[model samples]
Target chain A: MTTYFNEMYDSGKVRPPYARLEDWTRSMPAELREMKQAEAEALFRRIGITFAVYGEGGDPDRLIPFDMFPRVFTSGEWARLERGIKQRARALNAFLVDVYGRGEIVRAGRIPGRLVYRNAAYEKAVVGFVPSKGVYSHVVGIDLVRTGADEFFVLEDNCRTPSGVSYMLENREIMMRMFPDLFRGNRIEPVDSYPEKLRRTLASVAPTKCERDPTIVILTPGHFNSAYYEHSFLADLMGVELVEGADLFVEGEYVFMRTTEGPKRVDVIYRRVDDDYIDPLCFRPDSMLGIPGLMDVYRSGGVSICSAPGAGVADDKAVYTYVPEMIRFYLGEEPLLKNVPTWQCSKTDDCKYVLENLHELVVKEVHGSGGYGMLVGPKSTKAEIEAYRARVEADPGNYIAQPTLALSTTPTFVDEGIAPRHVDLRPYCLVGERVELVPGGLTRVALTEGSLVVNSSQGGGVKDTWVLAE
Target chain B: MILTVDHVTLYRYDRPVRGLVQSHRLMPSTCTGQRVLNWAVTVTDGLAGGAFRDGAGDWIQGWSVPGPVSEVAVTVRGTVETTDQAGVLRGHRELTPPDCYLQSTPSTRSDLALAELAATVAGHDDVLDAAHRLSGLVSEAIVYTPGATAATTTASEALALGKGVCQDHSHALLAVARQAGLPARYVSGYLLVEGDGAAEGQEAAHAWAEIWVRGLGWVGFDPANRCCPDDRYIRLGSGLDAQDAAPIRGTARGTGFEKLDVTVAVQAVQQ
Candidate 1:
C-alpha cells in the first residue's frame, strides 16, 4: 500500500512544470493521440533508430518503443543537477588518474587495496601512464531515479562509451517536429548542439602527435554490434568517419586510416569497442574487431582513445559505493547528488541482513546490466527469493542488495487513456577540458504496470525529456 | 660476470600475408644485478611502430610490416653485466603491487594435481621456506622432457602428466605457489646453458617463476634447473602466465599458417 509521488500532481494541484501538459492531455482526443503515436513510430522507423537485441527471434532490429508524451523538468531542478553531475564527473576522472599513477587513494586507506588491485576491470598494462589531458571518461552517463521532488539517487554510472545520446538527440528532434505548439510558450532548452559540443570535447583531448587540426574518427566494432546505429549516427552527425579495424593500421607508432587519397594519420579515436577487443597485438590476439598494434601506439602517446582504456574500473558496482568518498577525498567538497543505500553482500553482516530480508530488497549482479541477472524483491515470489538467496550465499562479493524505493511516475497515453508508468532519467555528461552537459537527457519508462525496471532491453520505452529555461 | 646474447627469431608463413604486426619484448634486463650494455633489437622488413618502458622494467617495441612478404626475422643482440644476489632481483622498475600477482589466470589456475603439490608445504612455518619448498616440489613432480607439452598447456595438465619442459615447469611453480598464498608470476628470459644435455633445449630460451618474499623483494627460481636464477640468467619480462609474458606477441592479416624458427646463443664474457 505504499504511495508513489506523481511528478505532475501533488495535493490535487498540477505541478508548475507539468501544468501546461496537464491541460493538453485533457484537451486532446484519444484518436488523435493514437494517430500521433503511430506517426512517431513511423518517423523513428524511417530514421533507422532500431536497437538490435541478441538471441531474439524473427528480426534483431527491435524498435525501442517510443512514447509520444514528453517528460518535463524545471529550470531550477536542472541547474542543481548540472552542478552535481559536473562535480561527480570531475571526481571520477581524478580517481582514474590517482589509481593508475601513485595509488594515493588505496594508500590513504579510504578504499581497500584488494578491491582495486584484484579487480577484473583494473588494467595493469596502463599502470603509471597518464592519458592526454588527464581525462579518462570523456563522456559519462549517470542513470538516476527519483522518489520525491527533493529526493533523487544515482542508480548507475556509465563511464565507458555510454550509448544513448543519439536517442536523446533523436527524441528531441522528433518531438519538436511533431508538436511545435508545445514549445511555443515554454522556453525549453535546446539539445541539438550536443554533437558539435561532443566533437569539440574530443578535439580538445587530442594527443601531442597532432600537427594540425586533430583528425578524429569514431572506431566501431562494425555493424554486428548492438549499438552500431548509435556509432554510425553520432559519427555522421559529428562529421567524422565511422571506421572498422581493417580501415586503420599502425605505422611507426602512429595510427593511419586508409583512404583513396592515401594513408592519413589519425590523432584521436572515439572508439566504441571494448578494451579486450580494441587491440589484437596487445590484448586478445584472435579478435577480429581490433586493430593490430593499436595498444602499442596508444601507450606511446601517438594517439588518444576517448574514455580511455580501463575506465570501466570506476563504473564497477562495487566501486560505485566509494564515489561519495571520492568526491570528498579528491574534490574537497560534499556530494550534491545522493546514492541509493546499498548493502554490499561481500560484508558478512550485510550478507546476513540481505539473506534475512530477501523479500523486500532488490538484488543485482555486480557486473550485469540491461535488466538481466537481477531480482526485484517485492514483486518476486517466495520461491524466487529462496533461489536468489542461495546464489548470494555462494558468492557474496558478486551481489549487492538495495531496498526498493517507490519510484516516481509520469502520466502517459495508454490504450485506456492517461495512466501512470514508472520512469528514470539518464543524463549524459561530457568531460574533457571543460565539464559540461546538455540540459536534458534520455528519459526511459517501464511500460509494464507497477514495473520499476526501465531498461530498453526489457519491456521499457523512451520519452523525450524537456528542460524549461529560466 | 658479463653475458653476451645473440638471439634471432623467424616467423615464416606458407603464403605471404597482407600485413604483419608485432610487439617485441626482447629487451635486456635493467635490474640491479643486471645492467645492459649496447643492446639492440632489430626487425627485418618491418616498420618500427612505438616503444615504451613498461612498469615491469622491460622496454617493449612495436613493429609492422606491410606485406605480401614471406619471412619476418626479429634479432636481439645485447651484453648485460650481472651479479649473483641469491636469486633476488633488484632495481627493477615494476609499479604493480605484489598482491596483484596473486590473481590467477586461466593458464595458471590450480587443479587437483597442483593442489596436491601445494599441500606438500602445508603447516610450513615460514613463507620463504614454503615458496622454495613448492618450487622444489614442482621440479620433482615434472621432469624436464622436451615436447611433452605444448606452449599453451596449463600447469595442472603438466603436473598430471608428470613430465614437461621449462614452460610447464614455470607454470606448475606458479600454480602451486599461488595456491600456497604466495604472489608469483612467470618470467620469460635467457639462461647461459652450455655443453650438451640442456633442459628441453628450446633454443637457449628459458622460463622460470618469480615469487614475492616478505623481507626480500622478488626472487626468481628456475624449477627446471632445481636452483635459483644466478648471474647467467637475463630476465626479459614477467606476466601472469607464459602467453601474457611472451617475448614476442603479434597478429598477421590474411589466411596463412606460421612456422617459428628461433636460435639463441648466451655466452659469458671474461670481464
Candidate 2:
C-alpha cells in the first residue's frame, strides 16, 4: 500500500506541516537512536502515563503506548471537523431528551423502544427528568475514522463518562519535548482550555440562591480508577476540591462537602463517577462511591451535578440510529453529520440482511464497551460468525451491525520506518451556555498490523492531534 | 420546648454485602412557648472513613465502624417546630360552606404566588383563583408522558421544557413559592389511599410542599394532586427539600448497577 506520508509529500498536496521533524528523526546517532525508545518508555513510567488493565489480578498497570510521530490536521480540515463535531453533539443531545421525554420518533415507529430501553445504559429513572439547561450529554466525544484524506465516518458515541481527554492533554505535554520543532512551527491550537470550559458548565447549573462564588467540586471514585490522572488533572486545572463520596453529605435538602473548617455547601459537583456509583439511594445500594442522599439534594435544587444522572439512555447504540430524526424533530434543523449505516437486529428485515451479510459487516453488542463482544467481519472465522448469528437470533435487540469500511490510516513511525495505521479522532466538547471544543483531541491508532479496533483496551496506541493554522 | 426525632431507612440489593449508610434527623422539643430543633446523623460504610458537608463548607469526618448484615440501612430523625407556636391549639371547624383560606383571589401577588404552586384552592377565594391559573398553566404546558421524569426531577428543567413528572410539578411549585419569597420546604411522607388504587401502581412514599404561613403556620400543599394535605396525609419529616427528608439514604461496596424497590403503606383510623 502507498504510505500516507509519501503520497501527500510526493503529490505536494500540502507541504508536510512538520518538515523539520524529518531532520529530527534523521539526525540521531545509531546507538542513541536505539536507546531513544527505551528512554521514552522510562519517561512514560516516571510520569505515570499508564492504564489499568482490568481483570489482570496482578501487575494491572501498563504504560499507554505513545507514537513518536503525531497526526496533524490543517486549519481548513480542522474547521470542518470542528463544525462536524458540534453538529453531531447537538443532534445526539436532542435525541437523548426526546427519547427519554416524548418518544416522538418512537411513536412515529422509526425506532423501536425495545431496542433502546433494553440497553443496560438506558435508565428508566430519568424518563421524565429534564436537565436544568435542557441539555444531556453536555460533554461528547464522537469517535471518527478517516478512510482517505477528506472521507470520514463516525464509529460510535462516547457520551457517558468518556475518558482520555486527560490523555490528550498529557500527550501534548510529552510531544512538545519529543518533537518540539514539529509542534512549534505547526501552530497547533492549544487544548488547555478544556478544564476551564468543564468548570463553567458545572457551575452553570447552580441553584438560584447559591453563594455568588459557588463552591465547585470534582467527584471521583478515588485513585483506584483507570482515569484517576484525568480526574486529578481536571481538579487541578479547575482549581476545585477533588472529593471522594465519603467527603460529601446531604442535609436539609443541601449538599455539603467535608472541609477542614466543617461542612461547606457544594454548589456544583463535576461527578466523574458513573450513574450507578453516584447515589447509593437511587442507584446501586452497594455503591460506596456515592452519597446516600445526593440524588435527593440534586432533585431539591440544592446542588447541581454535571452531565446529570441517566443521560446515558441516549448513547445506547440502538439510540444512535434515531439521532438524525431526533435532530430534525427537536431542532427543526437537518443534521450536518452522517452516521455509519447500521443494521438494527430488532428489525426482522435488517436482522435477516445482517445474518446473510455477516462476512462483510461488523457486529457489536449493544451494551458492551472497550471493544468487548465485537466481531470484525473480514477477519472472523466461519464458526465465530455462526455463533454470533445464533446470539443475535436469540436476542435480536442485543446486536447491531454495520459494513466494515477500511478505517483511514495515517503515517506512524514504527521500528521498520513509517507505516500506515488506522486512526480515529475523539474531540472533547464542554457544553455550558455554548459548546466549547478543545483545540486538539485524542487520536487513537490501531497498533496491530491491519487491525481495525482502536480502543485503548485493545492494544491501541495514541498520537497527539494537531489542529494547525492555515 | 425542644424535641428530637430519629429516622431510619433500610436497603437490600440482589447480592449480599455490607455498606455505608448516612442520615440526618430532625428532633423537636417544646418549653413554655418556644420550640427547639436538634439533628444528628451517623454514616458507616467502607474501610475508608466517611465525611459530611455542612452549610458553611466544612467537613465533619466520620470514623470507620463495623456494620452488620448484607442489607444497608440509614436512619435520620430530627425535631423542628416554631418556638412561638408552642401550646397553641388549632380547633377543627366543619364547613357549613367552608371558606377557602388557601385560595388566592383578585390575582394579587399573594394570589399569583398561590396559583403558581400546586395546592388546593377549593375554599379560599384568593387561593382558589390562583390555583385555577397555576393548574391551567401546568396542564397546558406539560404533556402527560410516562418515563419522562422521576421523583428527583428539578423544577427549572421541567418548567423550561414545560413538562415533567410528579416530582417536577412539586419542584416547579416550590420554585415559584421560593421566588415569591415564601419559606417553603419539601415534604416526603405517605398518602393514605382508600381501598384499591389505579393501575399506575400503589401510592409509594409521596412528596409535597409545606409553606410557612403567618397565622396558619406551616400549611401542607399537594401539587401532585392539586389539594391541601388533609386526612389522607401522614407527615414524615420537613426540610429545605426532598434530600433532607428522603426515607432511605446509604452507600454500598459494589461496582455494578443496583435495582431499588420501595413500598409504603399508611392506614387511617377514625374515632
Candidate 3:
C-alpha cells in the first residue's frame, strides 16, 4: 500500500498553511461540528443549489454534499499555480485557433493529423472563420490533482462550458456566513469579483458589428438541464438575460431575444448548449434547441459565441497528451503544469501493456464524461477488471490507461471524527482580451475512504478553497 | 466552354409561418476549372443577411423573410466559363485537411457490402488508379434509374436496391472510396447534360463524388455517368453528404406542412 500525502499535516506536524485550522477544529466539540454540517446543508438547500446526477434514478434535485473543512493554499503556492493555470489557458486558446485556421501544429508534425481532423469534436463548419479577439473556450476549466508536497498533475481540461462555478461562489459564501471569525483571522483573498470579471471578459469579445454598447445574454438549454442552476445563477450575477432556444430567433443578420416590449438584438451569447445543438442549419438537422442559420451569421461576424464552436476539439482525451507540446510551440515557453503519463491503447505496445497490467491501471473511454465507463484497477474486483479488459480489447482506439495516482488528502469532518480524504481542484480560467483567474477554485473531496475520483456524480463532496493573502 | 444556369425553387406552406431563415451555397466555385461571369440569387420578400467564404471555398449567403406568408420563391441565374483540367481541382484554396472528409456521415457509412466492394481495389498500388477503380465499381454496382431512391437513402441501401439517382451514386462512391482508405466527399453543382450526356440522369442540378489523390489534390468522378467531370460540370460546393452539400437549407417557424418544387435549366452558351 502506498502512503498518501496529507495537506494539513507533514510527518505528524501541522503544515504552516493549515496551522490555524488545527485550533479551530480542536476547539469545536463534536455536537457543534455536527450542527455546522447540518447548517451548511440547510443553507445549500435554501439557496436552491442542487446537482442532478445522470443515469442515477435517485432524487433529480439532490444536493451535493458539502464538507466544512476548507482546503487552504498559501499565497506563494497560489502564485505559481495561477501562473501555470493562465499559461495553460492561453496555450489552449492558441491551439483552438490554430486547429481551426491553418493547423500549423499538425503540419509541424508535432501531433498526428488523424487526432485533430478526424476527431468527432472537430467542426468542419467553423474552419477559416476566427471569432473576435481570437479566443475560443472563453472559460477554461483545468482539473488538477496533487500528489507530493509540490507535485501537481493535470487530469483533464474542460474547454466547453465547464459547470460548478456556482458551487465555488456558494461554498465561499456559506463558509463566510458560518465562520466569520476564521475570515477575520486569515487574510484569505475574496472570489466575489469572479462574476464581474467574467462579465467583463465576455463583453470584451463582443462582435465588431456592434457599434454601440453590446448586449450580452446567456443561452441555456432550459431548466431541465443538469447545470440549469449554474446558468441562472451566473446570469443573475452578471446582470444578463437568461434565455432558452425558443426565446431567441435568427432574424436578418443577428440573433434576437424576444422581450415584452419588442425584439432585442443580442451581440454576444454565452451559450451552455453543445456544438451539435447550437445551430440546426449547420449541424444536426433534427435539433430543436438550435437557432436556424446561426452559423451563417456567426461566420459573417454578425455575432460572437463564447467558447466558440469546435472548441471541444482541443479538450479531447486523446488530444490532452499534446497540450504541453502546444504550450511550447504556441507560447515558446516551457509548461508550468505537468501532465500525467498516459498510455493510449491505440498504439500496439501501449495496448499490450495495458492489457497485461489491467489490475494496476485506470482505464477511461475516449469520449466519456461524468466518470462513467471507467475501470479502477486496485479498487475493482477481479471480475470487473476482466470484464473491462474485454471492452478495451474490443476497441483499442477508444481506451486510454493511466497509472493509479496517489492523490493527496485533506482533513475532513466525518462521523468518527476528523479524518483524511482524497481531494482535487478545478480552477475556472477566463480567457478573452486578457487571461484571468480568481485566486480560489472549487475543491472536491472524496467522501468515501481511499477513493481517488472526485467527480460530483461519483460520490464526491465539495469544500471551500482558500488562497491566503501575502 | 460557357454554361448558363437558371434555377428556381418554390416553397408553399399550408399555413402562414412567423419567419423563415435560409442558408445558400448556390454560387459556382472559384477555381481554375470554373469562372463566374455573372451570378445573382433572389428571394421573394427576403433580406440579404450575411455572406462569407467557407473553409471548403464555397461562398455561403444568408437570407431571412419575416413571414406570415404562404409561399416563398427563390431564384438563381448565373453564367460561368469552365475549362476542366481532366477533373483535377487546381488553384482552389481550402483550409480543411483531407482527413476530415474521411469521416463517415449517415449517408456514406460503409456496410459489409461496401467493405467487400472496396476489397476489389486491393493490390492496386497506385493511388490514382485505385480511386478510378473504386469509382468504376460504384458505377457498375448501381444502375442509373431516376425516381428509384429518395433523398434520405444511404449508400448501402442504394447498392442493395441496385438502382438510384445521382445522389445515391455519389454517396455509394464516397462510401467505397472511404472504405478503401481514400478521403472522398459529395460535390453539388450544375451539369449541362446534352445529347450523349442526357443518359447521365439528365438532371440539371447534379451530384458527384470527389476523391483526394495524393499528388493531384481533389479529382471529380460522376459514377452515374461512368465518366470524370469535365467542362460540362460546374462545381458549386462540397460536403460529407448530400444534405451537407445542399445548395439551400432552410427552416420556417410555424406548424405548417411544406411542399417544395424545384426546376433547374443548364445550357451551353455560344462563346
Candidate 4:
C-alpha cells in the first residue's frame, strides 16, 4: 500500500498555506456546505460555462462537478512554480523556432533527426516560415502533479491550444461570489485579468503588415465542437469577434473576415481549429472547415496564427521526453521542472523491462490523451493487463510506460464529508512578446477514492485554486 | 541548352462559383541545373497574392479570382537555360533537411512487392550504386504506358498493374527508395523530347525521382525515360508525390462541377 502525500496536513498538523482553510471548513455546518456546493453549480450553469475540458467527448452540456473546497498555495510556493512555468514556455518557444529554422539541436546531435523530421506532427508546410515575435505556442498549458511539498513533476505539455482556461476564470469568480468573507480575510491573487492579458498577448504578435490597430478574431470549428462554449466564452471576454471558416476568406495577400459593412482584413487569428483543418489547399483536400490558400498568406508574413501551425511537434509524447534537453540546449539553463521518468517501449531494453513488469507500470499510448487508452497497473485486472500486453507487443513504438506516481491529495468535498483526494494543477502560461502567467490555475480532483487519474473525462471534478498573497 | 515552355490550364465550371483561390509552384527551380531568363504566370482576371520561396527552394505564388465567371485560364510561359551535371542537384538553396523527404504519403507508401524490390540493393556497398539499382528495378517493374493509371493511383497499385505514367513511375521509385532507407522525393518538370509523339502528348508534364546520396546530395533518376534528368529535362519543383509537387493547387467556392483541360509545350530554344 502506497502512502500518498496529503497537501493540507503533514503529520496531523495543518500546513502554512492551508492554515486559514482549516477553520473555514470547521465552522461551516454540513447543510451549509451542501447548499454552497449547490449554489456554485447553479452559478456555473447560469454562466453557461459547463463543458468538458480537452474535448473529452462526453456530454458537452454536462456540468463537471465543482468542489467548494479551495486548493491553496502560498506566495512563496507559487513564485517558484511561476518561474519554472515561464522558463518552460520560453524554452518551448525557442525549441520551435530552432527546429523550424536551422534545427541546431538536431545538428548538434542532442535529439534524433528522425524524431523531429519524420514525426507525424512535424508539418512540411510550415517548414521555413516563422511567425511574428518568434512564438509558436502562444498559450502553453503545463500539467503538473506533486508527490511532496517541494517535489513536482510535469505530466505533459499542451502546446497547441490547451482548453480549460475558462474554467480557471469561472472557478475564481464563483469562489469569490460564494465566499465574499473569505476574500476579505485572505489576500488571494486575482485571476480576472486573464482575458485582458490574453488579448494583449495576441495583439503583441500582430504581423508587420498591420499598419493600424490589428483586428483579432477567434476562429472556431463550429458550435458543435466539444469546446465551443469555451471558444465563444473566451472571445466574448477578450472582446474579439468569433468567426468560423465560412465567415473568413482569402484575398490578395491576406485573410479577410466577412463583416456586415464589408470584408475586413484580419491580422491575427486565434484558431481553435486543428492544423489539418485550417487550410484546404495545403493539408487535407477534403477539409471544408479550412480557408483555401491560407498557408500561402501565412508563409508570406501577411497574417499571424496563435499557436502557429506545426507547434504540435514539440508536444508529441515521443518528443515530450526531450523537452528538458531542449531547455539545456536552447536556453543554456537547467530545467526548473522535472519530467516524469518515462520508458519508451520503442527501445529494446525498455520494452523488455516493460513487458515483464506489465502488472506494475502504467502504460499509455504515445498519442492518446484525456485518460483514454491507458492501463493502470494496480487498478487493472489480469485480463486487462494481458490485453494491453498484446497491444504493446504488437507495436512497441506506439506505447510508453511510466511508474505509477504517488499523486498528492487535497481536501475535497465529498458526499459524506471533506476527504483527501488526488489532485493536479494546470497553469496557462502565455508566451508572446513577453512571458506571462496568472498566479492561479485550474485544480482538478479525482472524485473517486484512491483514484490517481485527474482528467475530467474520467470522473474527476474541479476546485478553485488559490494563491494566497504573502 | 536553352528551353522554352508554354503551359496553359483551363478550368470551366458548370455553375459560376463565388470565387477561386490557387497556390502555384509553376515557376522554374533555382539551382545549378536551370536558370530562368524570363518567366510569366497569368491567371485570367485574378489578383496575385503573396509570393515566396518555400523551404524546398520552390517559388510559390498565390492567386485569387472573384467569380460569377464560367471559365478561368492560367497561362505559364518561361525560358530556362539548362546544364546537365550527371543528374546531381547542386547549388539549390533549400532549408528542409534531406531526411524530411523520407516521410511517405499515401501515393508513395510501400507494399510487399515494393519492400521486396527495395531488398534487391542489399549487396551494393555504395549508396549511389544502390540508388541506381532501385531506379533500374522500378523502370523494369512498371512499363511506361499512359492512361493506364489515374492521378490518384498509389505506388503499390502501379507496381501490381505493371503499367503507368511518369507520375506512377516516380511514386513507385519514391516508395522503393524510402523503403530501402534512402531519402527520395518526386520531381515534376517539363521534358523536351524533340519530335517524339509521347513527349508532345503525355510526357510533357514529366516527373522523376531524386534520391539523396550521402556525399552527392540529391541525384535525379527518371524511371519512365530510363535515364537521368539531363539538359532536356527542365525541373520545376519537388514534393513527397505528384500531387504535392503539382504546379497548381486550387479551391473554388460555391457548388459547381469543374472541368479541366491542360496543354503543355516544351521546345528547345537555339541560343
lDDT for every model?
A: 0.88, 0.64, 0.93, 0.91
Instruction: Quote the positional error of residue B82 for candidate 2 in Å.
Output: 31
> What tier of docking accuracy does candidate 1 attain?
medium
Model 1 regions more than 4 Å off: A55-58, B120-125, B195-203
Worst 10 residues of 4 chain B by lDDT: B194-203
Clashing pairs in 4: none
lDDT of 4 by residue, B1-271 (tens): 9999999999999999999999999988888978899899999999999999998999999999987878999999989989988999989998988888999999999999999999998667799999888999999999888789999999999999999989999999999999989999999889886655455355577899999999889999999888898999888899989888888999899889999999999898776
lDDT of 2 by residue, B64-135 (tens): 223343554344444433223221213321111011112221111233433444344333445434433454
Residues A172-192 of candidate 2 have per-residue lDDT tens digits of: 887776656666666778887
Question: lDDT tens digits, residues A1-470, model 4?
Answer: 88888999999999988888999999999999989988998998998876655545556688888988999999989999999999888888988888888999999999898888988888877878888999999999999999998999999999999988988988988988899999998999999999999999999999867787899999999987778889999999999999999999999899999999999999999999999899888888889788999889999988999889999989988888999999899889999999999999999999999999988898999988888989889888999999999999999999999899999999998988989999999999998888999999999999999998888888899989999988
True contacts kept of each: 0.70, 0.11, 0.78, 0.75
Candidate 4 overall Cα lDDT vs. reference? 0.91
Candidate 3: how large is its RMSD?
1.1
What ranges in model 3 sit over 4 Å off? B196-201
Off by over 4 Å in 2: A1-33, A56-58, A103-110, A115-119, B1-271
Highest TM-score scorer: 3
Model 3, span A1-470: residue lDDT tens: 89999999999999999999999998999999989999999999999999999988799989999999999999989999999999999999999999999999999999999999999999999999899999999999999999988999999999999999999999999999999999999999999999999999999999979887889999999999999999999999999999988888888888889999899999999999999999888999999888888899989999999989999999999999999999999999999999999999999999999999989999999998878999989999999999999999999999998999999999998889999999999999999899999999999999999898888999899999999999
DockQ of candidate 2 against the true complex: 0.06
Candidate 2 chain A: worst 10 consecutive residues by lDDT?
A: A1-10
